[model samples]
Target: MSIKQRDANKNLEQTKSHLQSNHAIHHQAKKNLVQQPVTRFALFLLGTAATILGIYAIARHFSWWQLPYTSIAVIPTEAAQASLPPNINTNFVTAVVDRVGPAVVRIDAAKTVTNRLPDAFNDPFFRDFFGSQVPQPGRRTIRGAGSGFIISPNGRILTNAHVVDGADTVKVRLKDGRSFEGKVLGADPVTDVAVVQIQAQQLPTVKFGNSQQLQPGQWAIAIGNPLGLDNTVTTGIVSATGRSSSDVGIPDKRVNFIQTDAAINPGNSGGPLLNQQGEVIGMNTAIIGGAQGLGFAIPIHTAQRIADQLVARGRVEHAFLGIQMLTLTPEVKQQIASDPNSWLNVDEDRGVLVVRVVPDSPAAKAGLRVGDVIHKLNGQSVTEADAIRQAVENSAIGKDIRLELRRQGRTLNLAVRPGAFPTAQVE
Candidate 1:
């Protein structure tokens, strides 16, 4: 009986054991199915989040897409900015030209030149056959053109002395095409300034400016009839000031020219060299031949003073010291040193060397000797022959001039009263 019971119990236990194992396996399979779906959904969500983050980082780094919170102002390109005009007034030059262009006049001068026969042809035999008057010389009219400006309301005009010096008739043509016959009030060759009068009244006159106030690099405007071109305006800057007329080879003139770069041609003489304010600071007088940007003008102050004298008196008298001198240069000093018979012995190389002294003249009366080196005139150091010459001309006729000289390595001072320059004695 125990064996049978034991065997039944064992079979039942075995069946129970098999059913429990089956149930355990089925529960684990169901749990695995549920967790597999959850894991797949989480992996998909992580991949999507990672892709979105990568796209946002790329956009931020490259600025491919702008944020809504930012604002920027646009800037113009260089080309667009360069198209703007300068801050200064662009019409300044035009305004100055418009103001002074009308007062400038063109002068046409005609002179009768009589060509004479040779002295041999004027022998007594030929003179008798040609009828006692000796054959009359052929006469021809020489014509020249220049420029000038009105200085007074009564038709008084200012021009260069050379313009109408020997002219039989002088004609002035205005910018408005009205022509008038000009009468020579007076002409001073030493100053190269002259005044001509027309019949017209209430004419326009140029305003004079202070020539002493001119500075280098200041704007200069020149208005004149150059090469027969009427009312041509040229613009440039002041190159220099206080240039002597002899510096430009005008030996007879006693003018300190105002050097400018403004174009001045042959016909531009006596025209105005205006400042930026449209005031006449100078009178255009000469130009360096074959050189561009080399023009000179007489200072307005000098021209005005000379004009007043020529208008009041028939002639202007210049002061004379009566000495011929040369600037002491290294070459001149060497030449003087090499010459054994030269009365001049120059130890210093920077003064005016007096070469000749006119007998009984102011310089000779003052005891100025040949070979004496003039170091200073008054208080100014004399460096050039022209400087001393200009100083003499500018001094008062009766004024005493103190001359500092170096003779034989000794400094000497002498005083001289300048006399009137003889017109016939001028070389």
Candidate 2:
């Protein structure tokens, strides 16, 4: 009875174990099937995300798309650059010309000059021989052309004084082909600045920049009518600044010219010299004869200052001392002392030497002698003759100027009142 019971129990237990093993395998297979769908979905999502990121990278590298208010990080690849348009080149120079080209104008002046007969032709015997055939004094019209720029909307223009000096009529022509009759308000020969007014309104005017802030190597653009060419554009850099009048071989003019390499021709005078920002920094005035790349301009500040006075009073009052002076360098001093016929004696190697004093002039009345060596004027050292002239030009009429002089091994301080420059001298 025990052997039969043991065998039956063992078989039943083995059957139960086999059934349990099959159930466990089926449950694991179902679990794996369920997890496989979720894993495949996660992999699909990752692949889709990677594809989207790759497309965005390519588009951004090629600048194919852009977002609002966003800056693109350019890759600078050749393929990317090849896609850009060729006409997209706009630089600072073109921008300046487009902004400032309208204000530049052309000025034409006509003056009547009278021709005089020679003294021999006017002789009694010569006149009697050809009484009817003798050429009589006649008048002829002289015409000149130059450049100018409008400073005010009402057609107030600024040009070189020499352009309109003694002109019987002035004609101003704008870039848009509009012409106007110009009236010369005044012309100052000392500074070579003149103001012309026309009866027009709402004209384009130039924007003025501070010349005091100008430096070497800064961009200089000139817009003017050069050699009868209207609206000519030239570009160069400021070569130098603060060139004295004597340094430029124009001692009669009281201007500290701005030197530039910009091509300024005969008709370029009174044209605006512009900076990079299209603001006027100077007025083109002169060019060295037979020289390449050498041009001079009046600082806009000085021109404006003189122009203001001329506009207000129709004239400028420059102070004068009425003395011909020479800067006493070593060579000049030696020449003066070595001369046997000259009565003047110069003992100093430096200072301004007065060679002649006009009778009854400010220098004569101030007791300034011919041999006087002016060491200082108005508390400033004087080493160049231009310095004294500049000081006199800046001095107010009837204002006292302190002069430090060295005469005969003695230092003398004298206060002299400056007088108005004679109109005869300015002509």
Candidate 3:
């Protein structure tokens, strides 16, 4: 090959490589321009038209952005929340806070005690080390802080029974800086609602709202003295209702808890959980920590009833079913299916099984026998042991109800009368 030909070929190759690189660079520059802010903005306006139209035009309802926006977060307004069903309400949050805030009080509990060695303490080293003169530390009283709400204008307070259960002294602090030494009224173990008294007049009271009216997604407000910060208010929505926990055992229980997402913490116990209308719907009792959006409240329906009894007679009388029951798990359901006609003590799918019938109690008198699977009572269907217990408690004592029982291959209906529950004795 000639030297001149080789040199010409090299020059051609160099020009071709330079042109390819320039074309690649120009193509990338055009692509980058397509992703610029101007281009993206235009696309957003065009693509978001459907979303915006649905929000603003197709539906006239207000959303988070459409509702009044302000930097002055003057507490959440329930009127801003969407009402359930036909959606006809406004300013629930305001009504709730306004009606209940004054009634919400700061509860300060202190224990006064002299420590004594346990009666069971018998250490051999203690006898030798001090020559029978071992000095044990003196007992000291401890103080705990919590919150509660007044149920009456005349100084009756509603709080968790545990809040002042064993306290030597309890101080109730009002919003107006009035502190009253509280006297323990009566506490119920079934619902954990307690009534306490203060030696004062003309106190602020919170109006009780019907908890059964609370719906899922309704706004929930929590007011309490959390971490010693009095009058702390937090907001969320009612996530659910009718939550039951075995962690706190109450057989023949009528507790129906309202669950909320409001930030309830350790000191939130005994505080009023108000609905958007600012009405006391439940009492903040517990928080499942480490997990977000899990908080529980004692429903006001039971609380109010218990409070009335506590205030009037100092105790609540209950009815006895006299039957031990258990929740039907999946495994139990299969066992139940195997004998559709046989009376079952264990059912994985349905009603609580009547385990042991108390000799002379309501269940025994009502003909509720062992192995009888209770499916419904008084026309209401029973799904589990809790439902059975709740239904029975909610009903009046001495009332006769039709019970549906599945006995050997035949569905039997029996009528049984309930016995009056024993009155609670509080010390």
Candidate 4:
């Protein structure tokens, strides 16, 4: 009975184990069958994506489609163009420089300087011992440079009076590199205007514009040898016009200045101030210290008139009253009375006091006294001393000028004919 039972159990166990192995194999085969279709689909998708990326890269590398070019005309309107930088129209400046730069010149003035040698060097024994080694009276050249512009084809140049003043010789260098020896035709310190004559014919001339028509906020350009920089250009707007000489701190000069914000330095004194049309409107003159964007120029009309007078006769003759005067104010009157040494003692505080009347002059001939205060000139109120001088200068030479004076607290009207102003005795 035991042997039969054991043999049956072992056979049953073998059969169960065989069935479990077959079931395990069938499960693995079913998993492989299910995963095969998904693997193939994933590989196909990856290959298609790679192929599409390669095609795109090739198309981009070969410039398949290029961006369209844009023209300025296509900007549509001014409002759209307003988004652009302001200096885009710099071509106008470049063109103006090209047009007028050739006429601009650099003036180098050289003066003869003589220096005396020391006593030791001047000794006869030292001179005998050291022949050429001993120092003698040495003559050295002192040179100064300024700016100017040609005004005529026959080589008439315009510049400031201070530029070539006291210069023994003047050398002009044009922008095109031509050099010429210039002769000072005339120099008027009253207006600070000078005329130079060169020998060249067919010289380029700058076009002159009416400075009276110039308005503030108009474009102004200054081209000059500022600090010896040739043709250095600066741009700004016209700040003002008809600026009095007193306003510019140069009461001695009779200029009605054109004020601009364009940079004006030491060497820019005689350079021409050009308008937006590339025409000379003024002559660059003075700049105030401790101030930025404050530059003054002499009006071209005044300069032109002076230049005309100079060209006609090597000199300008202004009407002369021959009197030193001061604008009498309350403070000035009190200061004059308080100072015992003061000669200008006036009773009135609201008139121009005659400080001194030159001997044998028009004012002296008109019976103007030191204590007399001028109230009016030709019916115009004389609040400033320059007003009388300006009126006298504006009147024709030899014409009778009427002056109202307060002498000893009494108003007196006097008439006198003006005479030619001595150029040497001018401001």
- The candidate maximizing TM-score is 2
The candidate that achieves the highest lDDT relative to the unseen native structure: 2
TM-score versus the correct structure, for each prediction: 0.74, 0.78, 0.66, 0.71
Clashes of each: 0, 0, 18, 0
Expressed as tens digits, the lDDT of each residue in 9-43 for candidate 3 is: 99999999999999999999988987899988988
* lDDT score at residue 243, model 1, on the 0-100 scale: 90
- Per-candidate local distance difference test: 0.86, 0.88, 0.77, 0.86
| Winner by TM-score between candidate 2 and candidate 1 | 2
| Stretches of candidate 1 exceeding 4 Å from the true structure | 1-90, 125-136, 338-343
Worst 10 residues of 2 by lDDT: 74-83
Candidate 3's C-alpha runs over 4 A off are 1-100, 112-142, 245-253, 329-331, 335-349, 356-360, 364-369, 407-427
Query: Which RMSD does model 1 reach against the true structure?
Result: 14.2
Q: Residue 96 in candidate 4 has what lDDT?
A: 69
By TM-score, the candidates rank as 2, 1, 4, 3
lDDT of 2 by residue, 1-427 (tens): 6999999999999999999999999999888875898877987899999999999988877764454466453233343244345655445666677767888999999999999888999899999999899998999999999999999999999999999999999999999999999999999988899999999999999999999878889889999988899999998999998888878888778888899998889999989999877789999998878999989999999999999999999999989888888888999878877899888777889989988898889888999998889998888888988788878877899999999999899999999898988877631
